[model samples]
Target: MSRTLVIGDIHGGLKALHQILERAEVTTNDKLVFLGDYIDGWSDSPRVIDFLIELDKTHDCFFIRGNHEEMVLRWLTAGDDNAEWRIHGGQSTVDAYQDLDIHTKDRHVGFLARLNDYYIDEQNRLYVHAGFTNQKGVYYEFFRGMFCWDRTLWETAMSLNPALSKDDLFYPKRLTLYKEIFIGHTPVTRISETVPVNKANVWNVDTGAAFKGRLSIMDVDTKAFWQSDPLHELYANEKGRN
Candidate 1:
């Protein structure tokens, strides 16, 4: 059956992205949801965006806005060049666009601007670039900012006692709100292996393609995953925004 595949951060690692897609055997029948941070780390930020644009034209694809995309959009539309974004890998994206024509550059900006903060499928599976803060006594929409920057959500899930039943009164309601929550941003390598990590129904698929790991893609329902080789090997000689 065609599956709904959710991919994690690309971070400008075009080679890894292509490899993971091929490894997953993605077909036009599948629905692909990207968890964002598409630009920044590797040497082909512009190329990555271009590939995504074309992929969207040919398949069912959803793109979520990541902090890096937010920073770059701010720079493109509002002229706000935040240092934090630059230090975190935005420089590679900027450098990649230096030679592009205004039309192509604007297309990139338009694509980035249209990214969603989070996407919830009919099955109540939530897909977000980062995690959302379930502010006590408030609706989730009010804390949308958390969807793109919250580390606490993942950290809290990681800290939870694994033995608790889903119905345990003590189980976090925030985590139970959705059947499953898939996120990127915080790389899985920090917690365990260089693969997708699951904790408290939250699956983190960002295997750190921007840093030292590979890019990842997972079937939303089956939890089956695929990854590229370590990004270092993919782009053997490049520094890759390090």
Candidate 2:
């Protein structure tokens, strides 16, 4: 079987991403899927996008839109008035694009604007930047609190109300059509291990790489995972500065 390699939040760490792909021995046959947050936090947003554009051209790569990408699209389209974009590591993103040409900037912005919110494989594996809420259909339209929000709602429902957990919140019977759900956005301390939220069906892979946490990758077929140590040195001084 071909491998579907899922990568976690990049947050502009192109070096770490390259290292992980090299370590994982990624091949052209494998379908590489990026969970989102490809740019922001780190110092190489422009380079990261450039690299992603190159990768997409050469490999079967799937891109999903994260909250960061949404903010970037908003900034590019509507201008940065809300100030919400800057709070979530937009300054670094801006810094990265400072030297880029106008045409290059426009191309990257257009790429972000065109990103899909989610991807569902034929095997029933749902890949989204953030996991879905109890809300049933039309999952992608409910973007306000979807892509970057925590899974606390589902966790609370699972713990406080077993009856509610037994409902569609924990394990959506309709989702039985898919094999698994893979997501990122909410940062975790470790990315190699899968956190089973709904009976081992849903997995969170953000791994908090942008915040000096691990950079993670998962194989879709064997479900094996690989991770690199926290790139703490890359962002040690930048922490809390933003």
Candidate 3:
């Protein structure tokens, strides 16, 4: 049977991406939902975009725009090379694209433009790079950036009381908005988790590929996952947004 795979943040670790894809035994029939951060950090940022553009041709792939990608889009369009972005892995991404031909560069810009802020599946599963905070859910979310930068959704889920049931009146309405929410951006490694972490209805997939953690891809239905070698090991020669 075909499967829907939800991937975590990549942070330009193309080698890690390849490893997990192979280990997971991905097939043409599988649908890929990438949580984004496709660029920045590691040396393969540009090549990673190249691979993703090609991958979409053969497989069903949904790309979510990450905060890093937002920064990239800004830079690509208006040359907004702010230091905040540069210090946080944007410099590497910039350097990676320095030699690109105008045509390929424009194609990448188009690709970035096409990224979705959030995607909701038929099963009521919401896939976003980060999280949404509105109690009424995505449609009512006032700031679209929340989809790619918010942490309150995950924070609330993590801090939810174990005794609190969804049926309770005190239940967080945000959690009730969707059947399940898959997000990345904030690395699970910060909480010392080496694997995907589930809190309430929110599932965090970013295993910190931008830092020292592994890249992860999970089968949303089964919750079974595959991970690559620690990114630090894969790109031992460079400091990847560390």
Number of the predicted model whose TM-score against the real structure is largest: 3
Candidate 1 lDDT: 0.86
Cα lDDT tens digits for candidate 2, 1-242: 46899998888777778878988888888899898888878887778888998998889999998888877777766776455566677888877777878899888888897787678888868888876554453253455456455465334323353344434656544344346777777665443433322334566777777776767888877767787656566556565113
Per lDDT, the best of the predicted structures is 3
Off by over 4 Å in 3: none
In Å, residue 47's CA in model 2 sits off its true spot by: 0.9
Please give the range of 10 consecutive residues that has the lowest summed lDDT in model 2: 190-199
lDDT of candidate 3 over 60-112, digit per residue (tens): 99999999989998899898888988889998988888899989889999999
lDDT of all predictions: 0.86, 0.71, 0.94
All candidates: TM-score = 0.94, 0.82, 0.98
Ranking by TM-score: 3, 1, 2
Q: Over the full model, what C-alpha lDDT does candidate 3 score relative to the true structure?
A: 0.94
Q: Where's the lowest-lDDT run of ten residues in candidate 3?
A: 132-141
lDDT of 1 by residue, 148-229 (tens): 8888879989999989887899888788788788899898877667889998888999998888898999998888999899
- Per-residue lDDT, model 1, residue 116, is 92
